[model samples]
Target: MAGEHEHRDVSGGWLRAAVFGATDGLVTNSSLIAGVGGGGGAHHTIVLTGMAGLVAGAFSMATGEYISVTTQNEAIHAEVANEKAALAQDPVGEIAELADTYIARGVSPATAKAFATELAASPKDALHVHVQEELGVDAQKLPGAWTAAISSFLSFSLGALLPLLPYLLGLSSLPVALAVSAIALMAAGALAALLTGRSPIQSGLRQLLLGALAVGATYLIGHLLGAHV
Candidate 1:
């Protein structure tokens, strides 16, 4: 047990959805706030814009995640069904193919044939093995569509709420909101880096820089538009 360590389940779709949703939410809301504030918008108007962005963005992310995950699952299921039909129609050929796969992977021909034949004894086992070997996917570990959708929805809401919190609390300070959102963006990046075994400092700076660009561009556009209009 000393040397054995458990690996994180990166296969599930929730991690990607949550990270992307949260990052997008923070950047989008912060940029929206900056743009409106730069455009000489009143506090109440900025708050309203932020709120609308949060709601609309969250729903959009959730809907997109759900549809994407569902479509992927459906495609995987179709492939699995095809594999099942193949196994049923040609058990011998399927087993031979599986054995050849193993032999190609440095397994002895005799052992591969024996192992494939043994696995072929059970329909479920044979199907699972064939599907995994052929498709490189675990039939049992398919990502949940609802799980991804809900994760996206909740994470996006939380991220988008960070910049809006200042206005919601009656602060009406654009600088304070920007500071908070910037910190949050860096923190989210650092956390993601830690999860993925990357350099936290680099990741955090990357997020900060990217968010700054978005905010700056929007703010400049808003300022120019406000001056003209």
Candidate 2:
């Protein structure tokens, strides 16, 4: 039972947000660095471009998370509110709805009806069944928008700094950017996998290789464009 609960926790919305936010930070900032490096941009320019990417990407992630999560929260709240109203006005019908939900989930009709009747004997149990079974929602809980915004903003800025640090220390243009981005991407991948309970080695290698390819491809493009210009 404990192990089952742990697995269920891993599938929650918060974990989803954390993975998505971290990945956004890593990929967007890394790609920005590669694009700037490829364009034959100078060290200062590269740093500045990275800073810009950090800010822009952070804001974008926050806004996107806010809109999406808030929309979900509202929908869930509305459903709970409707359920409460229905329970107040039509307790029998609401009990029947809960039983029907259980029946739909493979329980026999008689067993579902008995289970729902027992659940509805207690008001709290009735609400729990209505919310969990009928609505598929956690009625009392909502994701914190402020928390999401702050985490996203901070994660992007932190990730963006990876590419900019070498250039800040007076390292040569392309090589330093490449090296820093590579290390940062690998680290991010490993961290993501750790959080998601996956194989860190595999995730790290995949992300590192992808980042390398992106930077290498963009660098070549920039070099060619620079030569022509």
Task: Report lDDT (CA) for all predictions.
Answer: 0.94, 0.74
Q: For model 1, which pairs clash?
A: none
lDDT of 1 by residue, 140-218 (tens): 8999999999999999999999999999999999999999999999988997785677899988999999999999999
Q: What TM-score, computed on C-alpha atoms, does each candidate reach?
A: 0.93, 0.84
The alpha-carbon deviation from the true structure for residue 66 of candidate 2, after best TM-score superposition, in angstroms, is: 2.0
Which regions of candidate 2 fall more than 4 Å away from where they truly are? 1-5, 11-19
Worst 10 residues of 2 by lDDT: 5-14
Per-candidate RMSD, Å: 1.7, 2.7
Runs of candidate 1 exceeding 4 Å displacement: 1-3
lDDT of 2 by residue, 72-190 (tens): 77888888888778888998898788888878889999999998888877887688668876666666666766666667666766776777777778885666666777777777788
Q: How much is 69 displaced in model 2, in angstroms?
A: 1.6
- Give the RMSD in angstroms, all C-alphas superposed, for model 1: 1.7
lDDT: which candidate is best? Answer: 1
TM-score of 2: 0.84
